[model samples]
Target: MLTAPGSLKAECSNCGATHTPLWRRGLNDKLNCNACGLYCKLHKCLRPKSMRASHGEGRRSGASSLASALSALASVAAPPPSSATPVVEVVSPGVSSAQCYNCHTTATPLWRKDEEGKTVCNACSLYYKLHGSARPISMKSDIIRKRSRHDARAQRSSLTEPPSASNTPGTPSETPSASPGVSRRPRPV
Candidate 1:
């Protein structure tokens, strides 16, 4: 079976999945499939065996999935009118002004609905989902952190490069542990 370059062949101890987009370490440093690892990390328990999918099951190519999502969004955003006359919308007191219910912020990269069907900002929604509690107002910041996406070609090139005589497996290389200008920061709760 074809696999991602630079990825080692390993079976997940939890789900017995041999193919995964990314491999992660789980309990006792055992290798785990991507889905199992993320689920275990979030819930602090093993993923249910029933959730495991068979080979080549429920997999959609990125391009096709993205196209379908865009088309669906377009259809929902602008539906064909039944008549030539334009529809007029009346503002109601019960209607929200697209502001986050939790943080009351009008600006957000994306909007999401909470468990109560209340509108919330992307950060607030994700934070609540992970923590199982409303995000603290004190933690809200005006600045949205920007993350740099590394080029896949550059990473592949680095991994595919041949080992030099001085940089053999036994000998330590002079390169830094992390790539230049990249900083790993802890996720804020």
Candidate 2:
């Protein structure tokens, strides 16, 4: 709330000192105490009786303006909103964005949506199957076989890779060996 000049007498909330408004003419605008030497800030001061009434009137005027604006808005026809309430989009499980809640593994080729709406890997699903926790209504035998083959190939490749320098000490430096009956040496041009 604001007031006309000389209408408000500000009292400090902290020190209980009453002060008249001091309008700084040049570089500063502050109200300083004649008694306690305290500075009174404009926003910190509570609204005076006249100031409150003036602010109340201003608020009423603003409300009337807003009401008039809303009525003006009602005159124009607008297309119906697609949905009254904003639809919260839910991401489907086993999509690229979906991660396993248990293992934090990014699902590849997507997984079947379990009853609890979770994306579970084949291994986890098999475990559940073994435990008789739940059975899938339909099974894809081809996918299961493909997944097994892929896993086996991955395991083999990992095993074939040479141990890192940190893992093996005093081991001879090794490069790729030629295949059986194949020579790596350069042939005559």
Candidate 3:
């Protein structure tokens, strides 16, 4: 598939052009056949060839080969981008790297494998903990962050305050005021 420098002549299947690509340089230069003006690109199949021929240019096999070759290159090249849509990773279990199944995120620290073996991230896990169910995918991160912060504050309060003074449901003395402008329950100080 490769040859010494200046010795990479390949006959284009589409254009029938004899091309000598600088294979070492990995250039996919576009070239036209001198006899018929059939265009070819030489990259992997040598000149990224376009299988879609011009009117009366060439057979469909050449065009199909070009299209297939380009698609194969695309599939090989697209993975490194990490932001491409429809990303499919073949991650093995027990590997340090893992994707969160719930949010499809790869932040490992934020993810945990739940009892059902699905990966759930921090916010999703907390949602499950609080609701005894999976968090809806439509749940906004901002709201979840706010709730997480509130939960953290409550945890701190519970550690420092007496059980009776904690304004829990059993404590009528610490109940929030029933004033018109006041909210039903005051947020923890």
Give the residue spans of candidate 3 off by over 4 A.
1-97, 140-189
Provide C-alpha RMSD values for all models, in order.
23.5, 20.3, 18.2
Report the Cα lDDT for residue 94, model 1. Answer: 56
Q: Clashing residue pairs, candidate 1?
A: none
> Which regions of candidate 1 fall more than 4 Å away from where they truly are?
1-96, 151-189
Tens-digit lDDT track of model 1 for 58-156: 234567645654664565575677798667677787554588899888777889999899899999999999999999989888888765556767888
lDDT of 2 at 81: 62
* lDDT tens digits by residue: candidate 2, 6-91: 64655432333343233221114433332122222335443332222121232336677466446645655465568775564677
TM-score (C-alpha, index-matched) for candidate 2:
0.21
Q: Model 2, which residues run further than 4 Å from truth?
A: 1-95, 133-189
Judging by lDDT, tell me the better candidate of 1 and 2. Answer: 1
Residue by residue across 4-89, what tens digits does model 3's lDDT show? 33445544334453432322222244333322222222323433334333442333357674776577567657355455565567
True lDDT of residue 185, candidate 1: 41
